[model samples]
Target: MTEYVALLRGVNVGGVTVRSADLKALFAESGFADARTYLASGNVRFSADGEGRALKTDLERALAERFGYDAWIVLVTLAEMRAALDAFPFDASDEARQPYVVFCADPAVREELLASAEPSDEDPIAPGPGVVYWTPPKGSSVDTAFAKQLAKPRWKAVTTTRNLRTVAKICA
Candidate 1:
C-alpha cells in the first residue's frame, strides 16, 4: 500500500465542521487503512493501493455522499510530498515569515503564473512539480495578488499554508 495525503478543500472551515474521528472512520469505511488526520483543516494521511487520481475521485464522491457536501480532494503520494517539501524555495528556518505550498492539479507552467504578477517581496516562486512557495509581506498586507489571480481561474487546486514547524512536524 502506498501512503498518501489527501488535501480537502472547503471543509471544516470557520464554524462549519467535521469531527476528525468521524472523518477517520469514514476513510476506514471506504477501505483506507491507518487513516489519520493532521491538523483540523482536512489533511488526511492513509494507505491504499489504488491510483491517486482514482482514489481522489472516490474520496470526493464518498465525502459528498456521506456528508452531503462536495469536497475537492487533492491526493499526493509520500514521495510527491517529499518532493514538494524539498522544492520549497525559501529556507524553512525563517519562522518569522509564513511559508505556503500551493498544489496545482494540472501541471500549469510556473512562468505563466509568475508573468501575471510583478515581482515583489511577496512574489511566489514555483521550484518544482505541483508546488508554489510564497512569503507574505507585513501587517494586514492584502498583497496576495497571485493568490487572488489564481483563485479567479477556478482551477482544480488547493493551497495549504503552514509554518516551518508544522511542515517539520508533518514530515517527521
Candidate 2:
C-alpha cells in the first residue's frame, strides 16, 4: 500500500464544511487504509494501491456523494508530498510572510502560474515538480498580485493550495 495525501480544496469555507472525522471515515469507507485527517481543513492521509488518476476520481466521487458538495482534491503520493516540502524556495521562517504550496493538477497550469508572475518581496513564486511554491507577506496574501491571479475562476478547477505549516503537520 502506498501512502497518499488528498489535499482537499475549498473545504471548511464558502458555506461548505466537512468535519475532520467524517473526512477520514469517507476515505476509509472508500477502501483506503489508515485514513487520517490532519485537520478540519481536509488533509487526508491514507494508504492504497492504485493509479493516480483512478484514485483521484474515486476519492472525488466518494467525497461528492458522501458530503453532497462538488469536491476536488490534489492527490499526491507521500514521496511527492515530501518533495514539495523539500523544494520550498522561500524564507518560511520569516514572521512577516506566509508560506504556501499550490498544487497544480495540470502541468500546464503550473507553467502558466510560473510565467504569469514576476517575483517580488511581497509575492515570490517558484515552480516545483507539480506545484508552485509561494511566500506572500503575512496578512496580505489575499491582496498580493499573484493571489489576485489565483482568484480568477479559471484556476479553481485545476489548483488547490495549502499553507506550508499545515502541510508540514500533515507530513509529520
Candidate 3:
C-alpha cells in the first residue's frame, strides 16, 4: 500500500466539525490502513493502494457521505509531501513571515491563480511542482491579495494551503 496524506480543507471551521477519531474510523472503514490524524485541522495520513486522483475522489465521496459536507482535498504521496517540504524556497526561520505551501489540485486553476495574484517583493508567490510557495507577512496572510484570492469560492475546490511548519510536522 502507498502512503498518502489527505489535506482536507475547511474543516473544524464555519460550523463543520470533524473529530480526529471519526476521521480515523472513516479511513479504516474505507479500507485504508494505518490511518492517523495529524491535527484537528483535517490532515489525515493513511495507507492505500490506488491511483492518486481516483483515490482522492473516492475519499472525497466517502467524506461527503459520512460527514455531510462538500468535501475537498489535495491528496499527495508521502514522498511528494517530503519533497515539497524540502523544496520550500523561503526562509521558514523568519518569524516576521509565514511560509505556506498551497497545494493545487488542478493545473489550470493553479495557472489562473498565478495570473491573477501579482506577487510583490514582500509577498511572493512562486510556483513549484504541483504546488505554490507563498510567504506573506506574519499576521497579514488573510489580508494579502493572494491569500484573499485563495479564500474565494472559486479556488476552494481546487486548492488548499498549509503552513511550512505544519507540513514538516506531519512528515516527521
Candidate 4:
C-alpha cells in the first residue's frame, strides 16, 4: 500500500466540525489502512493501494456524503510531501513561524498560479510542481499581496494552503 497525506480544506471551521477521530474512522471504514489524523485542521495520513486522484475523489465523495458539504481534498504521496518540505524555498531566518505551502490540484493550475504570483522581496514566493512556498515578511502586520490574491474566489477553488510545520508533522 502506498502512504498518502490528505489535506481537507475549509473543514473544522465556520461551524463545520469534523473531528480527527471521525475522519480517521471514515478513512479506515473506506478500506484505508493505518489511517491517522495529524491535527484538527483536517490533515490525515493513511495508506491505500490506489492512484492519488482516484483515492482523493473517493475520500471527498465520502466526506460529502457524511457531512452534506462540498469539501475540497488534496492528496499527495508521502514521498512527495517530504520532498516538498525539504525543498522549502527560503532560508531558516527568512521563514516565518507559519510558512505556507499552497497545494494546487494539477500541474496546469500550479503553473497558472505561479505565473501570476507577484511576491515582494520581503515575502518571496517560490513555485514547484504541484506546490508553492510562501513566506510572510517578518514583523509585517499588513497582509501580503500573495495572500490577497489567493483569497480571491478564482484562486480559492483550485488550491489549499498549510503551514510548513503542519506538513512536517503530518509527514512525521
Candidate 5:
C-alpha cells in the first residue's frame, strides 16, 4: 500500500462544491485506506496499489460515478512528492514569492506554451521527472499577457498547481 497524493481539478471551487468529508467517505468506500483530505481544493492523500496513473484513473472514475461529474485526478507517489519538493527553485521561506509546481500529464514538455512566455531572470526548474517550477515576476502574474495565454492551455493539459508550502505539507 504505497502512499499517493491525488489532486482533483474543478471540484468544490466557485460554489460548485463537494464536502471534503463526503469525498473522504467515497474514497473509503472504494477500498482506499487511510483516506484523508487536505485544504479543500480537492487534495486527497491515500494508500493504494500499482502505478500512479492507474490509481489516478480509478480515483477519477470512482468520484465521477459517485458525484456525477468529471474529476480530473493527478496522482503523485511518495517519491515523486519528495522529488517535487526538492525541485522547487525558489526559497520556500520567501512568502512574497509564489512558488508553483505545475504537474504535467504528458511525458513531452509542451514547447509551444513554454515558448509563449516572456523570458525572465528567474529560471523555471524541473526538479522531478515530470514537474515544472516557476516563480512569476512580481506583479507580473496578474497583469501579464502571459497569464491569459497560459491559463487556457494549462487547463487543457490537465495540469494542477500547488504552492511550495502546500507541496511540502503534502509530502511531509
Candidate 6:
C-alpha cells in the first residue's frame, strides 16, 4: 500500500471549518488505513492500495455525502511529495524571499497555468512536474504582485499552495 497525502483545498477558511479528528474519522470510515490528519489545513495522510485519482474521487464523494460540500482533494504519494520538496528551485540560504510550491491538481493543466503566469523580477517562478516553485519578495515592504497573480481565479481554482516550511513538515 502506498502512503498518500490528500490535501484538501478551501477548508477552514472563509467560515468553513472542520475538526481534524472528524476528518481522520471520515477517512477511516471511508476504508483508508492509518488515517491521520496534520494541522488544521485539511491535510490527511493515509495508506491505501489504489490510484491517486480514484482515491481522490472516493474521498470527494464521501465528503460531499457526509459534509454536504464538495472539495477538491489533491493526492500525492509519499515519494512524490518528497520529490516535490527536493525539487525546490531556490537555494536554501536565499532569505530575500520565501519559497512556496503551488501543487497542480491536474497535470494536464500544469503547462497551461504556468504559461498564463507572468513572473516579474520581484518573483522568479519555476515550473516543475505537477508543481510550480516560486518566491515572492520577503517582508511587508515589497509589493505582492506575483502572489496576487496566483490568487487570481485562473490559478486559484486549479492549484493549491504550501510554503517551503509546510512542505518540509509534510515530507518529514
TM-score of each: 0.83, 0.96, 0.96, 0.92, 0.83, 0.89
What is the lDDT of every predicted structure here? 0.68, 0.88, 0.91, 0.83, 0.71, 0.80
Candidate 3 residue spans exceeding 4 A from truth: none
lDDT of 1 by residue, 108-150 (tens): 5444555555546655455456656666543422446765665
lDDT, residue 108, model 3: 81
Question: Candidate 5 at residue 75, lDDT?
Answer: 77
Clashing pairs for model 6 are none
Ranking by lDDT: 3, 2, 4, 6, 5, 1
TM-score preference between candidates 4 and 5, better one: 4
Which 10-residue window of candidate 5 scores lowest in summed lDDT? 119-128
RMSD of candidate 3 to the truth, in angstroms, is 1.0
After superposition, candidate 2 runs with Cα above 4 Å error: none
- Name model 6 segments beyond 4 Å from true: 139-143
lDDT of 6 by residue, 1-172 (tens): 9999888888888776778998999999888999878889888888999988888888888877776775777788878888989888787457887778888888776787678777767778888768888887677323566577667776654778877888788777
> For candidate 5, lDDT tens digit of each residue in 1-172?
8988887877876555878999999988888889888887888888987777677788888888888886787677767778878866677666556677776664454344455556455544333456767666556555544455557745543667777678878787
lDDT of 3: 0.91
Candidate 2 lDDT: 0.88
What TM value does model 2 have? 0.96
In the predicted model 1, the residue pairs found to clash are: none
lDDT tens readout by residue for model 3, 48-135: 9989989999999999999999999999888888988888888889889999999888678778888888799878989877789999
Residue 58 error, candidate 2, Å: 1.0
Candidate 2 local lDDT, 103-137, one digit each (tens): 98878989987888777866888899899998888
Best by lDDT: 3
Give the Å error, residue 162, model 3: 0.4
